[model samples]
Target: MAETREKLLEIKNLKKHFRIDRKHTLRAVDGISFDIYRGETFGLVGESGCGKSTAGRTILRLYDASDGEVKFHGENVHARKSKKELKSFTRSMQMIFQDPYASLNPRMTVKDIIAEGIDIHGLAKNKKERTERVNSLLKTVGLNTEHGNRYPHEFSGGQRQRIGIARALAVDPDFIVADEPISALDVSIQAQVVNLLKRLQKDHGLTYLFIAHDLSMVKHISDRVGVMYLGNMAEIATSKELYENPMHPYTQALLSAIPLADPEVERTRERIIVEGDVPSPISPPSGCRFRTRCPFATDICAKVVPEFQEYKKEHWVACHLYDERYADQMKQ
Candidate 1:
């Protein structure tokens, strides 16, 4: 059984929109809500351009929200905060970016890059202490202190990611937003990084908002998972629950695409091919965002947006098919 922990972050109706050509608006994270509990890995999975990364950034306040509130430890992250307040918040919440090579400063040495947060937050008392901290962090992420003086280009993709993890952990943050941290690494390296993250989480009791497009990996590492489609959340549930009984059509389609290990299952299972490319967020289809491609879409789906509601305990979905009023009609 999963441990029920306190809520570390409360995101309510969060929206991050970008203005295009001064006329059109691209709603990256259109209005999504969820809670990240203390010491839990909450995975956000979606197709490319589905706004998973944008949502993660918006949650960390890297990008100012267009609307809605992100509360971390009961403080509104989107609200105006003083430098000290912001710094204090920053110290508690950190991010491990997607691209390891690009995220790290090519000019700076690994030690300096890792210790940047320590210097900014004034966590270290002296140069000796900072050096020790940097070296210790390098060791913690499975890199040697000797490699500390080397540049990012010298390290492999996995090692670069390890550096990224060390950088994020340097500040000893309670919450981390890992936006596709393993997507760039080789297949073999991906597992190593994921395992390293898990070990670190266990050792430090860290909470994570792990955003990725890989459903299999998300299921492996996450305690709970949320599925997004076209900048809108379609389903959310525990990893086991969601994988075993996916509720939304979009979620079903995504899971169906994952190949099964058994030869018989793989051969016989009918994949739910989502028809049509994803609609643009600039002018998203009215009512249900997925209605255009949903095979079961009806007039009601086109006319009224389905409310995101729980059909079962802890299993929330946004689809007309799951609506209680339409349950009987759906059966027919």
Candidate 2:
């Protein structure tokens, strides 16, 4: 047990590669690492196919990693833990899926859905106790006790998501991986769900790993934000630091794309549209993964892999350009 790895959940050199056709490997979550502190929301931002979901699932052991480790409360998550142990682990960590409609079972009623965790874990002693717990959870999520008798299809998209949230809360999890929880709902509903999550976190002291592309929403909710590109962490820093001074080119490009509410700011800000599609994760560029589209890429970038390291206290980046030349440019 190494010390200094504080903070609640720590992912060390986490890698998850899927073997496709037994020949080509899809490097879904390739060598990503980060630490999440207690009661803080760590937002993971990336475009589609960047393996944000894979990293979240791998952390939860929903998909066991191909390599590396996920640590929770200084315990190695990958170590051979029994079913009993895993069940115990489930009480501390949980996930809220992206699509509420698809994630929920069509056959199960809301009561069965939210109470499933409690029933499986034997948290309630009797049917009356279970019903009470279920009703309480329903009320917590802004759903009525009567709705508990109804099936998933009987509810709207937002209602289904609320049920999903209630199910996650059933276990009284300390840390939650909200895997794009608001993406499927109407734009109006998204804010309510996000607010619900925030309120839950504030009231319960819950930590979150929120994965989404709504950079604005992510920035709004997260204590810190990490940008991922092609299965690698491009940059990570506190929300304020990262937004004010995004070190990685990919992060800068992504931030640049964020439309400002003020017309004057929007007009003044220059958008960096990198030319070329994202390279295949199956056969990524040899050295710097972003070299294929990175504006600052050079000959050295094609030959040597850039190490992901911390140049500042909390900020981490994986680009070689964080060297002398780039540092001087900031002064200008």
Candidate 3:
């Protein structure tokens, strides 16, 4: 499924496998498919090492794909396009990384760091315009223009993240892949940054693939969400459908772990604590990659890989138990 319309990015069966040894390889992102519609926030939520970040990077072509295709605005991104063509795509898509402190270059001042992409993309024809643009972006991310002269080391972690966001927007991209943007910040600062992101998206009419392990944040910012596990998507649905009617066992397990803000709800919530460490991506389980920890796994789950298919209108799941027609048989 290629990306089309105002849909800025689409990925189909995208895979990124890393060869660990002569005989072993880790399927970091294995055949995941999804589309990011125009001006909407699509969140990817999963546990660590589940390839959420890898999927994002691979879609952006930061890592060469082992298989599958990535389309940007109706064009095949992986195809050999001209430098100008690729640059055009790059300008429309940008990423806000997980960590602000580490993602920024230590040697460069905030102004220079943000200006780097603008300069590379030649976004500004002159220094004055570049400065004005940089300052405006800085203010948009809730930082002062004067702060741009300071180095990244001079700010707190959250402040640095704000700077990182400023840098990503410097290129005036239409889509932003915000990889766990709030996870590293303090609780107090997290909401501030998130609100800033929401405001920016509203004012700029930007689209996003908001990646996070924090389910609550994903629900707050995302219009739709995809739950990934062991390099495969377990389910995809509207934020409301996913939270209220999660069908896949993995999705249910994830929601069970989220601490409800309300006291009565928290007490009533059946906290699902899946025992055992995550299965190694080195050689994921044969059928459902999540079958090892899934409570309902059976012989068929271990024998055949479940296809990610739509079970309801616009809601897709990969578990055999939710196969719709075969659901009763699976339960029996």
The prediction achieving the highest TM-score against the true structure is 1
User: Roughly what TM-score does model 1 have, to 2 decimal places?
Assistant: 0.97
lDDT of each: 0.93, 0.90, 0.90
TM-score, predicted candidate 2 vs. hidden true structure: 0.94
lDDT of 2 by residue, 26-81 (tens): 99999999999988899999999899999999999889899999999999987899
Give candidate 2 regions above 4 Å deviation: 1-6, 324-332
User: Which tens-of-lDDT digit does each residue in 132-238 have in candidate 1?
Assistant: 99999999999999999999999999999999999999999999999999999998999999999999999999999999999999999999999998888999999
TM-score of each: 0.97, 0.94, 0.95
Give the Å shift of residue 172 in candidate 1. Answer: 0.8
User: Which scores higher on TM-score, 1 or 3?
Assistant: 1
Q: What is the TM-score of candidate 3?
A: 0.95
Pairs of colliding residues, candidate 2: none
* Models, CA RMSD each: 1.4, 3.1, 2.3
